[model samples]
Target: MTSQTEIRVLEISPPESLDSPEAELFHGGVDVEFAIAKQERGYTDLCPSAEEVLVSLRSQKYYKKIRLAAVAGLAGAPRREDVLGWASIDLPRHDNLHLAEVHVAVRPECRGRGVGTALYSAAEELARDAGRTTILAWSDHRDAPSTRGDDDSGLEAEAILRPPTGIGGVPPDDAPTRFAVRNGFQLEQVGRHSVLPAPIDSEHNSALLSAAEQRANVPETYQLVTWKNRCPDEWLEQFAKLRQKMSTDAPMAGLEIEEEDWDGARIRDEEDRTLAFGRTSYVTAALHVQSGLLAAFTAIETVARSTEFAFQGDTLVIKGHRGNKLGQLVKAVNLARVLTENPGLKRIHTWNAAGNSYMLRVNLDQGYRPEDVEGEWQKRLQESG
Candidate 1:
């Protein structure tokens, strides 16, 4: 063990200015870790492209709630040239405002040297200053990902291991998990991550579209409404309803996740956030003509810098409107739109709970494959005396 040095941690650039040396180092470190996380999980497609990373690094919207603190080497001299590591503290504004999510990453060579501890200290300080009562973190394990996407993948993985189980889960001595547990954090929940290959096979896609279309009434009882960025005012209210339903409809495996409490204003904020981040969201909704409301919806978000990666956002079908294959319908349509709009983006990544069989089935049918498993951890910051 090495002595703790005086490493300096500073908040990153103001939204208006992002061209300083420190800013670059912080963003570059985050970008590097993005790829590293994917490599660690051995996933073909589970991270933002380097280009996307830089683009987001410079975007105000992406960093709005995100507080980036970069740690510098404590050379004990005048110049601190090397960037040891960084911490990211996300303060959710509208919902879960009291919660602060954190991510602390240090250079591989810098581990066990107290760099991560310093970074977490910075993050917790930020969270506590923001009046956050609880801080949450996530740890992604390598062997936890499914080798293949099939009925047995989820079941077998759970049978084989439950993360943080202390038996076969991320060990107490593991790097990421160890860092948190050592700092008084407890395991919260785990989620299965997956990815969908882009530029879907022409033959398979056509058959899939045809299959979903056949589920809806051929007489056109349900119609499709789509948009590039913002939801149409006519459908805004109904869309909000679907979004709220999604917050609770999905399975939350023992996690303290609160409903998004969506509304038209929040919808607008989401759209604005997408624009601020220099990204585009291709959205599709199934409109129930008789009910005059949206029955189902899905979205595909793309960053300008990362033409090869697209994030598959929320996809939901209201309970009453379920079973019409709307999940498949909306997802299929949006995937097609993403492929057509951004041909270079060859992969669409998404995450789902292992128990979410219905959504998993729809995603599997749409060409998604297993990628990795992520576990959420939480630490109720004890009030400092």
Candidate 2:
């Protein structure tokens, strides 16, 4: 049994500096939540460190986001020990101004006691106040070994909720799925999370790269360019274009994300943030040697805490450049470079829309194995006249 009186939801103002007492307190709460979540989800590479969270809160270069936490303390800023759950409402400022992403997490022991509900309610109120029409949230689940339905198996077909894309499904009985359904949110899309064991045999990588190049049938004027940490001045403009295309061209299925605007300044900002988080990034671009412009690009970044893990960023082959295997070319080139550079990096994790067969095939060819499925849920708010 739970009541509104038991848990109080409060806004968490971004701290002035990470060294501040407030920062330490808030970080403690946030880190605990992440630890619990990682424990429940059984994924070590998915969660970010508390320092990363603080850095994002301090700077809103891309999204105007706010955090709310459910607490049980007296009338004041809640102490770290009093936090029962937290939620973040991320409002896109540039292109998708009407969309808000809400993420909620409650302590494992405090779940089912209204902590998550209180935090989500507070976050949703903020989004509503900002006039956001489409609210999106995500839930993570372990990947099912198979999505097949057998009449003799006892599990009914209706027990699994498959996205309209016809690629992935999630059990509706799970807590997260049930919560989303109960909150009037529909499971819009399912994305496959994959992990590629790293330090891939150098010989194997070379063979794949060779095969991709042969398949591309690219002109002798096409070449591969690699960089670390920062984009070169000469390629900044074209790199920005590739990123913008990635925003619009990527398979989104039924999600309501809009085309994002990216410029050289935004790219620089992102690079700085990645460095600030103590992570190193590797970038590979498939350049049209004739035009001196990037036609496709891919990025991989090392995890801050450990060298054994990294996350694959955007991999895009711009329009007019696809079907030539530019996607595989860049991905293979970048992976080979990163694996050789980070000897300790053991695995690289990535996600793709279930329906994105092109990129999925590219990833699978590079040895990426399915690790989990994530549901992107959305709810459209009615006009609040």
State which candidate has the highest lDDT. 2
TM-score of each: 0.82, 0.92
Best by TM-score: 2
Candidate 2, residues 232-350, lDDT tens digits: the string is 98899889888888887888777888888999999999889999888999999888877778888899998769988999999988787778888888888888888877899888899
Worst lDDT window (10 residues) for model 1?
Answer: 164-173
Error of 2 at 213 (Å): 1.5
Alpha-carbon error at 263 in model 2, in Å? 1.0
Error of 2 at 231 (Å): 0.8
Q: In candidate 1, how many Å is residue 375 off?
A: 1.1
Worst 10-residue lDDT window for candidate 2 reads 145-154
Residue-wise lDDT of candidate 1 within 197-274, one digit each (tens)? 766796787777778888887338788889999998988988898888888888765555678778897789768757
